[model samples]
Target chain A: MAVLTFLLRFLPFLLFGRKERPSPVLDSLNKLLPSAIIAVLVVYCLKDMNFRRIDNFVPELIAVAVVALLHLWRRNNLISIGGGAVVYMLLVQLVF
Target chain B: MKAELRYAVRQTLPVMIGYLFFGTAFGLMLQNIGYNFLWAMLASLVIYAGSMQFVLVSLLAGAFNLPAVILMTLTINSRHFFYGLPFLKKFREMGKAYLYMVFSLTDETYALLCSVWIPDHLDGKKVRFFIALFNHLYWITGSTLGALGGALLNIDLKGIEFTMTALFIVIFIEQWISATKITRVPAVVGLLCGLVLRLILGPDRFILPALIVTVTILLVLRPSLDRRSGEKEEEGSSVPSKR
Candidate 1:
């Protein structure tokens, strides 16, 4: 799962990761391999997703949402995340 | 080399606290469910998802049939697709280690690696590899320990799964602090979708759908968001002036 995820996350940078002025080693790898791995990952993700009835897991969902809002307001700062985490921790433990 | 590894470990210390305890719980849960260290390690290393590991304990115990496992895997991991999309190139040339590196990529590690300072003086991929390696170790080690604890004691792990929520919050905080409007946009979408999805799809299926929705929204806005994130990354990664 993580491997597929790595490929999925990293591959699209193929088009966008390129810089007119490139970092040779990094640039070459970016051009060549990311795509192959991404293909494999896509298969993996699809395979797992193809079947099954999904359930609702609320606490984490809410946490993701709150964090997203906080990210917008605070710009991914750790302190702000701290606030977000504290809220999530409380909510998950207490509310839902 | 060891010193660099040490530094990496130190940097991940705060996260370690959460990983360690959560790992212990996960380990214990799986152990109680008839899994051992090998199983624990495989789950942590292969799946590499903290929440999934705990949920997997039940799944592995035959809690659900094949269909349930499939649905759960997809739903739990949907967000990862986009997370990896941006870093594909880096993982490609990572050589033999690339496979292992990819196997261990998690939301926390990805966020940390994405924002890491690309050292001007040395091998960037190697540096990134170490970062990935470092986080992986934390997880691998944490899982081994968790399984050990579960083996020793008997307790219902259903409630303990909440650790993942806390962990996500921590990761969310870490990203939120360093993120900008562009990065935050996906997160915001995750939030809104997560909320609505939770209500509609319920908690279990919310993440994947929310991820799809968020990614689509981000894709639509990519040009503008990329322009913004690119600017921020420039400002964020540039060297500070030496006094």
Candidate 2:
């Protein structure tokens, strides 16, 4: 499993060497992909969102808002994440 | 060298926070499933991918089929292949540290390494090396600690996984804000495509297909997108290239 994980991570580097620049198309894709991937990942994290229960919705919204607003306000990764997670834990444990 | 290592350690502080929680969760889960601390440490050291390691707990509990395990590993880690694209040049120049970089390229480390700024006095290679090394150590230490004492700690951690989610949300916002108009296209497309696929295919099956569709959309939109964003490409470089 480890070897497989390493190979998957290392394949692109192995395929594209240091001496050569990737083609123009790939170069463009390289720039484009990070934003796309990160966006997709956000959705991936929220993939299990359950909309049937209005009760379940409030905490998620509040937690996500806390995370976004805290990040915007502080721009400190730790503050934003730690704040969000604490609020989320409190909500899920006590309120919701 | 000490200063550079300190800088690396400081930069990885957020990841250290996330990894400890994540690794502890993994350790506790593995312990629940009848694994020992040695097993958790082994998995953390070897199959160090965070999400995949979590998935691995269940896989280990299930019937051991090698082919099934290999396929599962590939699918879970397919996103990693794209990560190395931006780092290809830099990794190739890292001397002996190149292999370690490749070996430890977890999601959090990749984000940190991508955005790391090397001071003029510090060696860039060493900074990157230490960042990767420190994050790796944190992960191993967290999992080992969790395995050794997770049951004793025994606090409710229901929504703690939100740490990872929150991290991703911040990263997405950063990308969205920094992205150029044309560059934002892919980000929007990814979110829309992923949502639609998730609705249609349901959550579990959406990711791979969503990724494929997003890439295809980007390819089709490349010419116009490139023309619009062309000038800013050099200015707003996505990944810091080899210097």
Candidate 3:
């Protein structure tokens, strides 16, 4: 299983490394893919979201809103993360 | 080299916190499932991918089907393939250091590599290597500690995993705001595609399909986006400042 995992990771380098330069298409995709992937990761993080229950839904909503707004205000990754997490912990533990 | 190591440590500090909690959770889960710290350490060292490692604990305790494990591993880690694309040139340039980079390109490590700026005098190659190595070590330490005494920590960790989620949301917002030179099409397309897929496929199966969808959309729209943002590239807006 470990070997398979390693191979899946290594395959891209193997395919693109030993050859001609990456096509312009690949270059454009490379430039554009990071943000897209970051978005995917955000959705991935919220994957378990169950909105059917108000109690379960409110904390996640509040925490995410806190993260987005805090980041927009300060543009500091640390503050947004730390503050949002604290709010989330509090909500889940005490409020909900 | 000392300076480079310090920078690497600084870059990896947030990861240390996230991994410590997430990995400790992994260790705690393993212990709950009757595995020792030794197994936790080995998995963290070998399997390495955080989400997959958590899933592996359940797999290990339940079954011994090698084929099933391999298939599951591939599906869970398919996002890793795209992580290598942006690093293709750097990996080739790093020569011997390339293998370690490949081994350590987890999601958080890749985010750091993609966005963090190496200091002017420091070696970019070495900084990248150390960041990867340091993050890997943090993960290993977290899992080992969690396995060793996770139950004794006695803190409610239910929502602590939000650290990772908050971290990513913060990065996404930063990218959205920072990528002024490029059209924001990619970010919007990615966000929408992810949401649609998550709704259609659910979270467990949406990632790979979302990746494919995003790539296809970008490829089809690249020419127009290039035309729109192409002029800004020479203005140095293409390179957003370090986060």
Candidate 1 lDDT at A10 equals 48
lDDT of every predicted structure (CA atoms): 0.56, 0.83, 0.87
Q: Can you tell me which runs of candidate 1 are displaced by over 4 Å?
A: A1-96, B118-123, B150-187, B223-243
TM-score of each: 0.61, 0.89, 0.93
Number of the top candidate by DockQ? 3
lDDT of 3 at B102: 93
Give, for candidate 3 chain B, the lowest lDDT window spanning 10 residues.
B234-243
TM-score winner among the candidates?
3
Residue-wise C-alpha lDDT for candidate 1, range B38-126, written one tens digit per residue: 88887777677866777677777875687776666666665665555546556667769766665666766655565455545556676
Question: Candidate 1 vs. truth: CA RMSD?
Answer: 9.0
Q: DockQ for each candidate?
A: 0.13, 0.75, 0.80
Clashing pairs in 3: none
For candidate 2 chain B, which ten residues in a row score worst on lDDT? B234-243
lDDT of 3 by residue, A11-86 (tens): 8898886766887877888889888888888888888888888777799999999999998889887888889999
Candidate 3 on B34-63: residue-level lDDT in tens?
Answer: 999999999999889998898888887896
C-alpha positional error of residue B53 in candidate 3 after TM-score superposition, expressed in Å: 1.2
